[model samples]
Target: MHSFVYLASQSPRRSQLLEQIGIAHRLLVAQDHDPEPQDPEALEQVLPRESATDYVQRVTGLKLDAAIARLQRRGLEQAPILCSDTTVSLGRHILGKPESQEQAREMLQALSGKTHRVLTAVALQSGRKRLTSLSVSSVEFAVMDSAQIDAYVASGEPMGKAGAYGVQGRAAAYIARISGSYSGIMGLPVFETANVLRAAGFAI
Candidate 1:
């Protein structure tokens, strides 16, 4: 079994999720590389339109590929690598992290009193083998007023999270109910993540 897996995401939520399951991991942040969302034109070009699941999976694969290249360059090919991406979906539309306070407020208003799906994709790569898994969770938000949205936006928690909200943070008060893995909605699905790691020959 591998001693530890290389996590290529910078989200503390992912790291906490891994630790929650007792999975030993080391951060493998892509130095000097900025992770950007797919261009609007490119995203619109996907045939038949990509579902939230497809979007997250594609992004996760791209990050894993990048991490693998980085590892190879660093001469650390022996360790398995893990990468994940999360996105919020309202029907066919994908909602990524907000770029500004206004965007966050808009996202929150759009989600007010509605049910949205959160999709998280995890990828594990070890030597010549690779595995991927996805977790989907539905979250229902209560009707949120502008005051609440403003306060949350000012907190700065929504800036780096999908759907411009964090279920485990202050936004929890706005969430009326959740019907899936909480950890998954947070960014990393613990159940699927553990399975991928074990399948990739990493001992949890």
Candidate 2:
């Protein structure tokens, strides 16, 4: 059993989720000055005709691969490494993080009075072994007028969140119903993550 794991994600929610489970982990984020850096934006680019499930899982795998390489490059101590990716989709349309307030407002408007699927994929690498899991949740937003959408966007909470909103933030007021893991909607699924960690020989 390992004493701790390495989490290769910039999302503080993921880290908070891990902490909630009593899992000790250190961030293994890439540095700008690294000789070989992974471009997060490039890695998250949606491919033509890609399904939400495929996109989230593929991105998680790619992130794990990059993290594994990062560990080797840094000669870090041997331990399990965890990586995850989340995407919000309404049918075939994948809603990624909004680049600007206008985009955020547009996403919020589209999601109004509708239910969308939030898919989160988690991957773990331990020694020569790798494991993965996916969690899918549905969130329904109540009908919102332009003012409501604009108010939320003005709060700036949707700027860096997938689906242009965070379930645990001010956006929660507009969430009429949630049919899946709340933690998953926040960017990490605790149940799925704990299972993956256990599979990787961690004593979650």
Candidate 3:
């Protein structure tokens, strides 16, 4: 068991969650100079007829593979490498990060007074072995008028988050209820994350 592992994600929230659980991890994010720097965003493009579960798992595995290769390229010492991916789904439709303010508004409006699924997949690579886990949670939203949607969009909090809103932010005001892991909706599910880490032989 190692004292710390490599976390290959750009989300600050993931780092904070790991710290919250007393897991020491080193950030192993992709750099602009990386050989496949564009792979991060490219991997997220939804495939034709891809279910949310498959998409999240596939993307998480891809990220782990990339990170494993990256670690070897850098000649870094061997330790478990972790990666995660999250997506919002309304039925089979995957709601990705909004490209514009209007799109953000549309996503929020569509989610009003409805239920959606938030799926987060975590993958861990230890030596030549790999492990993965998934967390699925349902969220119910209160009715939001046009004004509410517009104001939330204007806050600029929906731009980079899946489902056009962050669960830990102002959007929580409109969430009437949630039926799964709150940490998963925030980007990384600490429970599933800890499972993979322990499976990879981490002391945590």
| Steric clashes per prediction | 0, 0, 0
Clashing pairs in 1: none
Per-residue CA lDDT of model 3 for 24-114, tens digit only, reads: 8999977877767545668788889889999999989888888887898889888888889989999778998898999999999899999
> Poorest 10 consecutive residues of model 2 by lDDT?
31-40
Residue by residue across 1-204, what tens digits does model 2's lDDT show? 899999999999999999999999999988877955667789999999989999999999999999989999999998889999999999779999999899999999999999999999999998888889999999999999999998889898999899899999999998999998999999889999999888877776
Over all chains combined, what TM-score does candidate 3 have? 0.96
Residue 90 lDDT in candidate 2: 94
- Candidate ranking under lDDT, highest first, comes to 2, 3, 1
Whole-model lDDT per candidate: 0.84, 0.92, 0.90
Ranking by TM-score: 2, 3, 1
- For model 1 the local lDDT of residue 15 reads 91
Superposed model 3: Cα runs more than 4 Å off: 35-38
Of 1 and 2, which scores higher on lDDT?
Answer: 2
Residue by residue across 22-53, what tens digits does model 1's lDDT show? 88889887565644343433532333667777
* 1 or 3, greater by lDDT: 3
Model 3 pairs in collision: none
Q: List candidate 2 segments past 4 Å from native.
A: 35-37
